[model samples]
Target: MTTITTRTVEYPADNLTMIGYLALPAGAERRPAVLIGPEGTGLSDVERRRAEALAELGYVALAFDLHGGRYLEEPEEMLARCMPLLADPDRMRGIGHAALDVLRAEPRADPDRTAAIGYGTGGAVALELGRDGVDLHAIATVNALTTGRPGEAARIRCPVWAGVGSEDPIMPPAQRVAFTEEMQAAGVDWRLVVYGGALHAFHHPSVDHTVRPGVGYHPRHAQRAWRDVVALLAECLPVTD
Candidate 1:
């Protein structure tokens, strides 16, 4: 197994002191970087582990925080914060840019070669970054099918891939169709994969805390989504030895 290092990074975003998890691969050579966005519940061990996994794969990865340093286990709290934030595009872009700046500042991250992958609310932030005209090699989102302002998707300069649970009421078929239509109208390369028989947040593991109805995990689909994400990165931002 390749040795990797991990650390906590504090940065400012969305009027909060964001605490992000940064993972670096074994070598000192600058490498392709990726931003991992957490779900609406905020950053947690799940996202940190993902950053570490990406680092092990030879990419510098930073799991950016959404809620300062706290994780909201309560559905009410998560929605209270995320709902309003999701409605505002500029705010999401602010958070994304702050995290991207921190990632690029790291010595091991290659600023010119980067990608963004996000889940839930974090996924919306990733899409916001693309709509804001940030240069990215690739963008992938799980369960976040947010459509941007009219004609804003024209700013996206990279391929976008999104995965969602077929039965996710939060991101149902209509929302998916709207999102894809916007992407197509803007002439951006995009694709969407719907995991059959899954629900919202299907990529996430089941938790002990109370969750909204129609939210559950599908282990098989989660693994498949991860593989698809890795493939997207390999195709768009290959890490060189």
Candidate 2:
């Protein structure tokens, strides 16, 4: 088995010190890298594990924090912090850029061959990075399909892929249409996949009692989404052997 290393990294963003989890694959040669953004509940073991998994697949992965090192188990707290942050594109860009800086600084990361993938509120952050004109090969998001300001998406030069649950009220059909229209108007290479019968956050595992209303897990769809994400990375930012 290929060796993998994990560590805690600290950086500054949005006027706050943020803690991120980084995973590196074995070998000294530089490889493609990915920046991972967690759900609105903040960075948790879920995102950390995803980073490690990516490292195992021969890519450097960094799962950055959203709320300093705290994980919000309470729905209200998560919304209170995420809603406002999502509304401010500048703030979201700041957070994404901070983490991207850390990832690019890694010796094993190929700065020019990088991608961004996020979940929930973190997904919006990833989209913001693409909209802010960050040079990335690909961008992927799940369960967070928010549309950006007029003409701003044109700044995104990378191909984008987004996945959401078809029944998710948070990202309803209308919202999905709007997001796709924005991508279309921007002339971006984009694709959207709606997992049938799935709910919001279907990619997320159950966290305590946080499962409520339109939010729950669909194990089958979750695995499929991960595979789709991996495929996206392979197509856009492949790590050659």
Task: Pull out the clashing pairs in model 2.
Answer: none
Off by over 4 Å in 2: none
lDDT by candidate, in order shown: 0.96, 0.94
For model 1, how many clashes? 0
Off by over 4 Å in 1: none
Native-to-model Cα distance after best TM-score fit, residue 154 in candidate 1, in Å: 0.3
TM-score for all models, in order of appearance: 0.98, 0.98
Candidate 1's error at 134, in angstroms?
0.4
Candidate 1, pairs of clashing residues: none
The residue-by-residue lDDT of candidate 2 on 1-241, one tens digit each, is: 5599999999999888899999999988999999999989999888999999999888999999999888888889988999999999999999999999999999989999999999988999999999999999999999989999899999999999999999999999999999999999999999999999999989888753396799989999999999999999989988798
In angstroms, how far off is 215's CA in candidate 1?
0.1
